[model samples]
Target: MLEVVAVCDAILHSPWLLPVLVVLIAIDGPFPVLPSETLLMSAASVAFGTHNALAVTGLFVAALIGSVAGDFLVFGLGRSSHRVLARATECEGGLSSWVRRHLLLRPGTVLVGARFVPGGRLVSTAAAGRFGLDVPRFLVGSVASSAAWSVYMLLIGLLLGPITGGSPLLSLLAGAVMAVLTAGLFALVQRVRAYRARRALAAAQHPTEPPLVLVAPR
Candidate 1:
């Protein structure tokens, strides 16, 4: 806790912190392990302590822009090399096999929910690119979602100020909770995917099985 507070104080006082924050957000859009929310919350807490409202707002906007830019870039890459990516991954077979075996078959909720899950954001973004979703629509959704996420984290930090006696303990606790929740959600989603895949395989293997006949005759 002392270490976290020290780091936060340094970032808030440093001149290069804003640029570092932007870089971290950008990298997080392509890499799943960056923990964008923790960074945002930490930055927000620092800004709150220093009364730097403008800097805090800028950080949020920058994060949203970075997310949209990265997502769009991947989308374009997916579009341009659709054939190559498909061939490389063996589109019809390997891709489908992965989707089934790893429980990525149904991505509807997962795609939207990924923005909230640590380590899942990039995977979901890459999956969206691979699936050929409309770029403009995706950008709109990403911007909105990223902005909302940024604000939520900032609020978390502000709220923690009162609860933890102005300590950084709340920020660390929030990060831990987010991590645990994300892991649980990911596990549940995979389970659902597995169940769905098994059902599909069973149906395919026994297509000719007649429906059970309910006989009321004597």
Candidate 2:
């Protein structure tokens, strides 16, 4: 515990922490930085232990600004290829299809919901632009999702503080486990939903087609 405290103390005092946090979350693609979530959780856990309201506030503010900035960049990238993307996704299925058949119809829900899904953030934001979703609507969804996700992650760090004896490292490790489980659960739900949608689509396409059944072999 002493060692953990010392390490966290050093990290919290580091002048580079906040700058690094903002930079990492604001930029995307080939850069060697710890996952933004990990850094945020680390800072949050330490703040939780020390009751550093400033740190928590900083994390939230950084996350909000950085996330929206990054997302806007991706959105712009997608917008640049808007015409090509629209042509490419004219058919149904895949991300392109989702953007056309679904996402286009429910911009706000998909944008907000995507924040919780792994890789969903970039994909959805990009799709929004690729599909030419209204800028005003996108901004609303972007801010809302960023706020919700920041709070969600901070809450995880805070909840783990006491459980890990106020050790930021332990809280970070525990938070990683929780994050993985949460991501896995979300992924599973997405897969299941996709599978069901496929099945329904198939059924509609072939009303007279026989259903397949499987049996275990000895």
Candidate 3:
């Protein structure tokens, strides 16, 4: 653990960290396991103390660009799977059924909000591509979300500096813990929602018959 912390501290203090941020953000676009937010926060804390505002701004821009590229790549992959997804949508089962039951009819809402929600981000993007969303529209929504996410992380990092005593490592760790908790909470909510949805479907399909009316004999 000490070695890891030392390594993290070294990296946080390194000049090369900015490029590393770009690659991490790219990976994070499709995979939630990567803590891109934490990285940005850490970099921001360092920049705050060093008075390197340009680094902070550059990091945000790099992250945003990487995210946009990553989302587009995943969206393209999803488009390639269009035939399979279409078949699944027709079957009224699995993720397709859940999406149809829960999500709005308009694809734009899904495209815009997916990037804000955990798990939903990449999945919804892929779904949009699979559903034949216009490439231009999809790119527009993706750019918007990526920009918002980048700015949010940068600000969070800057704000966290004072809170963590300008310790970039601690701030990064806290952000990572928060991300993990957020993901866990999302998973729990999804499980409960899925259970409720399944129960409702079952009740609708096989509702208990009303108690038989007993004829009173005079």
Give TM per candidate.
0.60, 0.75, 0.74
Query: Which candidate tops TM-score?
Result: 2
Cα lDDT tens digits, model 2, 55-150, are 889889988888888778777877887654345435455454565556767877777777787766766777788778888888988889888888
Evaluate residue 194 in candidate 2 and report its C-alpha lDDT on the 0 to 100 scale: 86
lDDT digits (tens) for residues 21-86 of candidate 3: 778777775565775666676777667656678887888788888888777776776778856434
| Per-residue error (Å), model 1, residue 72 | 2.6
Per-residue lDDT of model 1, residues 32-80, tens digit only: 5664556566566655655668977887776777666766655565556
Candidate 2's error at 54, in angstroms?
A: 2.0
Ranking, TM-score, top scorer first: 2, 3, 1
Candidate-wise lDDT, in order? 0.59, 0.72, 0.69
In terms of TM-score, how similar is model 1 to the real structure? Answer: 0.60
Ranking of all predicted structures according to lDDT, beginning with the best and ending with the worst: 2, 3, 1
In terms of lDDT, model 1 sits at 0.59
lDDT (Cα) of model 2: 0.72
Report how far residue 158 has shifted in candidate 2, in Å: 1.8
**Candidate 2 segments whose C-alpha is farther than 4 A from its true place:** 1-13, 28-34, 82-96, 102-105, 202-218
